[model samples]
Target: MRMEQLASRLTLKRAGNLVCSVCWRRYKRSSIVHQWSRYWITTRAQSPSSRPSSSLKGPAALGTQPTTPPITKKQFPSQLELRAVQRLDVLLEDCQEFLQKEVVPTEDTILDALKTCRKLSEYFRSVKDQPALSTIKPGGEAGNLLFLDADPADTQTASSRTLTPIAVGRMASSIAEEAMDKIAETIKRIAVDKNVYITSKVLQEVVDILCLLNRPESLAYIFILYSSKPVPKPNQRPLKYTKANPDRITAAIPLKVAERALDAAIKVQNLPLCLDIIEHTVSTKAYKRAKTLRGAFLPAVAVAMTPGAAYIVASRLAEMQEAMSTSMMTVIGTAGIITYIGTTSTLGFIAVATANDQMQRVTWQAGIHLRERLVREDERAFTDKVACAWGFADPRRRGEEEGPDWEALKELCGIRGMVLDNVELMEGME
Candidate 1:
């Protein structure tokens, strides 16, 4: 009762002044007390006891009422966020388990052995947490905890032994197909989820594997493009398809894969990969992206476009770069010139590659000339057109009459490095 009286009196004292402006000396304590009592008496209208209870019917009654509830731990995210982290942990564990038990081990011998071992080691590591209540059931009823140190040598790995060529080829194709299918699904899922969290290379091993497998085709195209500098005519089939069968199945499997690979290659801005893929695309005649055989020629425009190769050739073309024709240098002693255009030292990779290709054109002409000479030695004129394409000068005139430039051209392409001494008597060319 006394405590209630103290409370009521204190509340009244505090409330009346509002800002506590009343100085204790100027306003007598008894006077302030009288004013507060009067104010409460008027407000509550309760019994005039020493204890003017807060329960008295007025604003004072509700002033001491319990406030808006304080928030509990349940109302905040502290516990929920922890739960989410736990869920992610569980998801990771589940993924490990799925890979171990579900995925059939690949028998491909070339797959990195250490990588597969680490994969297994990581899978069963979560078994440490789950305490077992049963004896025979063991640590985890879901699955037996894999014994890490159980056996060493006998463990069957992906790279246990080298595969036969036939088996290796089949395995390679299967691996590629698997990766392609997986990546396709993954890309689709990412699109569906609108997810940006997913990354390339690490999680997308499947995609990387598939991309790497398609590398042979990529390499082939690079070789072809490197050899053939000039883009073919619009009428040319595949730009360099079997000149024999220019109109084959224009759209094929390898061609489609190569096109897709090029698309991805451009996105990542990978030069080596792009160069390789471009080479392969050209070699395999895999220009499925092009609607027609002629359309594939667009890639030719971009060939040797990489800065490292192109700028080096462009910047140092004068004294900076020169063709290295060692054979020509051997025949024509460097009188004034120390080294000819095709010398080993001065010649660029591009020049070497170009010369080699020009040589192939020479061989092709030789073959046609051989055929024509067999049928009719008469049409020497037709062979001249073929000869011109092979860096060969006019056939009508003698060497001196053809002029200095023509003679130089002839000297440069002399003998074509053919081994006439060891020529097989069986084959006519030999």
Candidate 2:
């Protein structure tokens, strides 16, 4: 009886060791315990009749575990993200209020709203593909902590919040499209009434939007306002106007903005407007060192219009031949002489006009100013026509003192050594 008991105990101990070794190997390799291995070993060790099988092929033979889907981490908004959302909400509210108000908003108010609208548009574009989360989940400790400090008011605010970047952007865009006339009027008022310095960054943002809206006329208007020289004090107050003591005129906008305005004018193909822009550029003090006024402005016009001038000369010569029975050689010689004189006078005029006042005085005394009188009285009509068509305002005709605007002569728009380039718009020559 003792020997049988000993043999049974040995067999049970051996079976227990085999099951433990297999489980221990599995745990070492896979880092997970087989659930049934502990129970099987204990039952066999106690009973000894149901011996563990050595033919066991490991944890796989115990049947597969009931497969479970993974528990994915839930995303929650960080403090920074929450703050950004709050800021965006406030901006949208302000913008909506501005849009709904019947009265036109102030310049600062309008500017603020515009900036908000732009921010919303940009934000929507950036996050268009991203999933939006409205609220935190109630299951997790992180989610509970996220809303722990929130009062009833915050909860109500969160619940009532209807603003989204896309919604705000669309609202602003649609309102702008619907009431463009009012927008134009407001912008015109801002340009004329407000003297406060608007940064080029803001101006550029507005300009880009205007371009997108296809409001070229408004763009042209803005260009004219910014680029053109401000009306002299005397012009503004006609009672104070005097030819000899006229107030100095300076442009309100800086050089770069003025250039943008010129491009805007040219885009609209408004010749008179182009001439006005050129006049402003010529008068700008920054272009003094360059040959903008003397070499580029008038000279470019003279060159471009030379063909038309030649045609006029040829027509006159033919008329003279028919009336006086003159030879073709005489007519051709007359035309050549006229062309030579005209070209030489134009060059000489440019040189003298750009010279010091003393030199201009000498040239004036040398009867250079008398050249216009020697031309036929009939040609005066043609000259006036050309001047009118080109929108050329003779600086000499203006009796104002030719002095720079001392106050505005400093570096503008934080730019140093800036100069307006010579861009000759020959749209009217056709």
lDDT of each: 0.30, 0.37
Candidate 1's displacement at residue 196, Å, is 5.7
Residue 426 lDDT (model 1): 18
Model 1 worst lDDT run, 10 consecutive residues: 69-78
Write one digit per residue (lDDT tens) for candidate 1, span 287-404.
3333333443554444434334433443444333246454443333332132333244335533432232222222222333332222221112222222343333443322223555
For residues 1-430, what per-residue lDDT tens digits would candidate 2 score against the true structure?
9876533322211122321221122212443222221222221122333332432323233343323211101111222123234444555455555555444344576576556444433332232323232332222343243345543333332123333434333332332233343333444444443332333454565665443333435554554444442322322322221222111232333445445555555565454554444444433343332323434567578767766676666666666555445456455755686678688977886665534222111111123333232221112222222233333255343222232321121112012221111112122322
Query: Candidate 2 versus the native: TM-score?
Result: 0.25
**How well does candidate 2 score on lDDT at residue 289?**
24
Error of 2 at 72 (Å): 36
Return the TM-score for candidate 1, rounded to 2 decimals.
0.18
Tell me the RMSD of model 1 versus the true structure.
32.1
